[model samples]
Target: MMRRFLAILLAAAVLLPSCLRHRPGDSGEATQQKDTVLPLGFLTDAYQVDSSRVRDGETFSGLMNRLGMGARDAYTLVQRCDSIFDVRRMRAGNDVEAYYSADSSGRRLEYVVYHNDRIRSTVFQCRDSICGWVYSRPVQKVRKIADVTIHNSLWNDMIDAGASPLLIVDLADVYAWTVNFFGLQEGDRFRVVYNQTESDGEVIRIDGIDFALYNSGSFSASAIRFDQGDGGNKYWNEKGESMRKAFLKAPLQFTRISSRFTYHRKHPITGKVRPHTAVDYAAPTGTPVHSIGDGTVTLCGWDGSGGGNRIRIRHMNGYETCYMHLSKYASGIRQGSRVAQGQVIGYVGSTGHSTGPHLDFRVWKDGTPIDPLKMISPPSEPLRSENLDSLGKLYQAYLDTLSAR
Candidate 1:
């Protein structure tokens, strides 16, 4: 049932240049182009996002090593962006794309995580778009068509693929929301088919994610994330379901549930309050804790053994989630870090007022702590109705393809 639910909901492609032209120009060396690059082909080898690709649950450092994406690349992707679409959990049924390499490594250097909700798609080519009012007047369309095939390096693949400038802009806007663009591997993943400018082939963009799939666990769960409210990169399910919750599911996916929220219970340490304010998630010495929503970091730094590495975030709706007793925070969870929801702010450990390694998870409302597991969450952003003109047909076609299989 979950597989059917996921497969039906999400999906998303690429190509490059040098794949065009009738002849490879017989010029000895000055202008001789070898292989006649495909209309669009792989720049680097493709790898599914499974255990073979992940170095850590939160990060996929090992995939970088094999794909030739070193520490610098990995660090850049991890530090700047909190959560990246790591390929370690990618399933074999998913797509793995690769575009050409501008560098000598011959890797599909530029990669992005494309979710078909169930099957993780991998496409090679341009993902970045440059936006500027390209024309004098504005134009509208009912249906859009974009068929791109590219060859050359990954960077060039995107260029030759004729990707729209607006799509690139949209990609950048949500770079922090889903996957990390900076720390791409030799063979990462990407897939898109957006609206483009007709004359002069000047591309605009496909405003946002019509439908996308993110791979995880045994079978991938379908997810379609897009933005709304002016220019916020708010992601949602294909049916416009919001993935953002009032509080994160268990602080982090890997950490174990140490304790549940209780109104009246004996305190493990002092045996006084009989009121447990937070639930604890147990983990190793340096597990990172994340900010559950978009808010200002109110407190950070060490506070003693009971609260070793304590950090707090004051949220928009007077709601807040707290992580207590950490070996350390993730760089800057300081006094004023403006963080989005689901962003990593610190690691897990035994810090303040605790025993062993664990994260004391707490949620607050009206400036008071509340049970995180109880609140109802809002839905994710949905695609604009105007944008859905071409979506129905496109979705049906993809569904036909899936059903046939």
Candidate 2:
């Protein structure tokens, strides 16, 4: 069971440019075209641009010194970059651009641009004054389609389909409330239509998922993105029901269930038959453990009953949950502390029990220990009647777009 769950956890890729543009700007490339804006808002025709990567163990001050700037000017430039862009963040191997004056035998450097990442950069002026400011490339949203069949696991299959791992994470988040990802079987398949934020023809991040369908031979679940004047977007099914539930399906994102709840079970360490009510999730140590539902921490301390570090939370409707063998509690989490659903409350660890790193999770209903896998959670509010037609139209439009492929 744990191996299959691990296989499921270890699981995109077509590029379809969307019609939406995030901001007004062209690709920051040095071009001969008139008025062409290079990086840092400098016109390519106005200056000679030299691009290079930051050498290993090179500092901003050292770069300036190598560029012929005096020590005092480099020091002042470093000081001005404090609040704008910390010089310490100028990581090695990152791209850097130096702008030189057009008509100069001196070959003097006027502006230096350091790429913080692919999308963000910092421009440092070094001609006469020492100042710096941050700049971000204009991002554009591109709709992408990923249709994959589960051969081994979602992770490996999606990767084999040329999809980004980031997209897999997003898809997992979209179905966090409903899908039993740990129970994914062979031949299962899914299709998703999502948006990717792109800059300079490269994906910056996943904007969001618009539509998704998971087919497991016997059951099919569809998620459609819709908004009904809630000032935020949400996912719903074809019947106008919300996809979000009161609690998440699991406490951790990607891990295998090492143990199941059973009355007749043998303890691994003790080698004795006993009732094991908790579901054991086996993951690496320090993996974040999240609260399945919103609640207040009732008990956050060590357990002397061989459970090790434990946290107990009381929820609504006479429901309570316990997380055992935590390596440590999340910051600000203690007795009486309020926690939101899906919030990280602790991390997976092997603190007290005789086993490797894992989270021992248990749930109770009216003071009776229950199986968490069998627990059913209430769904969020459905779409209002007035908004059903709008959702239908939007969902159909997405379907048409997806079906075109």
Candidate 3:
């Protein structure tokens, strides 16, 4: 009986290996194996995922609570991750995700992910211990070249060419001192080489412009971005001359000339003719008014009933600029305060002797009012002699790229 039992056990062990082997047409339990891959680097296939956008007046704690996270764990996460990432900075309209795992009591929150922007996110891990970490998606920088021709306006032409709207701001900044954007005519052309930043195949923003060429009528100009190795970067021409000037071409961007400077003109509000020395720029109320050049605030107050809210800045070489009919003054814009060129001093409004919202911009030379439109500003410093050659070579290379097609 012992020898018969041993023989049966040996035969059963040999057959068990063949029985466990899965075949192509087998309908056994082996086909039900679970996938082990994790999504978003945190949750596994077994967990359920839900996404939501942050609503108005909703806090991070409130969001976590709604996702089944306990109050104690939420508080612990907020407290511990304060230094690494501020939970309170989560903004409305941004996306958030919750991951849940099933237990004896049902599904429970395990992790929460907050999307900061296109390239950044924050994860709150709450499985075994309450902790959080901030992570960024990989970004790809692509070099692009564009050639645009104008038929109506620079803004419209650039937009029609499949370029980002942010590119217009960068182009304005590069040629602010030289080109007259408001006066761009038909047949004007622009060629540029720039960097576009993308994440997950979607464009986030235009990183910057490397080189640009603008031709309008017989006038032609080029701007090249060069780093000076001192944590400073500036735009320059092919001749190594800085593109910046002592004064900007306009105090505000994308505005029209409502009224030009004249010796005698009919007031829009009043019927009587008067000397309207300042140029009136018609813009919506709250349009920012910028300083034309670096200067100190000579005066910042309500100029009686005619001038409304006003700020006057005194610059070098007996130059002074005045911005009138402001809705309010910018923060810290007090008398004797130093301000830089393009700094916001006030906002446009229809206050004190105006028919509608507009900025009465005026400039003075030696206390005498001058036409703000006709005044020519000198350029800023040029590149050093030692750095000019290197910048010239780089500028030529960029120009070659622009001319490639």
Better of 1 and 2 by TM-score: 2
What TM-score would each prediction reach against the true structure? 0.42, 0.74, 0.78
Each model's lDDT comes to 0.49, 0.81, 0.80
For candidate 1, the lDDT comes to 0.49
Rank all candidate structures by their TM-score, best first, as comma-separated numbers.
Answer: 3, 2, 1
Residue-by-residue lDDT tens digits, candidate 3, 76-101: 87887786678668899999888787
- The list of candidate 3 runs beyond 4 A from truth reads 1-39, 42-58, 66-70, 79-84, 97-111, 125-135, 230-233
How many residue pairs clash (N, CA or C atoms closer than 3 angstroms) in each of the candidate models, in the order given?
46, 6, 0
Those runs of model 1 whose alpha carbons end farther than 4 Å from true positions after fitting are: 1-222, 225-235, 241-250, 270-273, 302-305, 379-381, 389-405
After superposition, the stretches of candidate 2 with alpha carbons farther than 4 Å from their true spots are 1-73, 79-114, 123-139
Q: Please, what's the RMSD in Å of model 3?
A: 11.9
Q: How many clashing pairs in candidate 2?
A: 6
Q: After superposition, how far is residue 161 of candidate 2 from its true place, in Å?
A: 2.2
